[model samples]
Target: ASYPYKTTQQSCKARSSKVGAIKGYGNTLRGDEEGMRQALDTYGPLAAAIHTTTDLQFYGGSSSGHGAGIIDIPSCSKQVDHAIAIVGYGTENGKDYW
Candidate 1:
């Protein structure tokens, strides 16, 4: 589904019947890439994080975002400042991406 970008905050107007429910939550082993990958393959997508960068801020832009490459930062560590779901992983143009 598509959501229009709103400049101001909007209150939730969703009907209770239409809202999806979360059953429960589980935590993946911390700082374990292989374990996270196996969990994603076995169960489903897991919440993960990546180091934010200025280049990532331009994700919506045309040229810079169109490349078939994976963004990797070797100096990045487990210090997460943001969170996102680990839906799936695959290779694009012979480069593995998440």
Candidate 2:
């Protein structure tokens, strides 16, 4: 399958605004902003980088337990499968992510 299943740069940017737009439960993580924040902090830089239309669409796909809609988080088990913006920074596995 082609990477970044999403169709365009506009759509790619749109996906980031949705928190848990990829969670397993519908609208779940409603109050877990901090948890997501912590995740971004430590793993943001490690998160994949988008440098092209292809890059933007690179991690697009429907994850399991994503519910009946498209608001479920990507699989933590799947590396480089979903696109997330790195708004924060930190280190993990000795990797410098920003």
lDDT of each: 0.66, 0.41
lDDT tens digits, residue span 1-98, model 2: 33434344553333335454432322215335566566655544323423233423334333542232222233333234456554664565665434
Error of 1 at 34 (Å): 2.4
The TM-score values for the models, in the order shown, are 0.60, 0.22
Model 2 regions more than 4 Å off: 1-50, 53-56, 60-86
Clashes of each: 0, 10
TM-score of 1: 0.60
RMSD of each: 4.2, 14.6
Model 2 TM-score on a 0 to 1 scale: 0.22
Clashing pairs in 2: 4-57, 4-58, 21-71, 21-72, 22-71, 22-72, 22-73, 23-72, 23-73, 45-98
Instruction: Find the 10 residues in a row with the least total lDDT in model 1.
Output: 60-69
lDDT of 2 at 97: 38
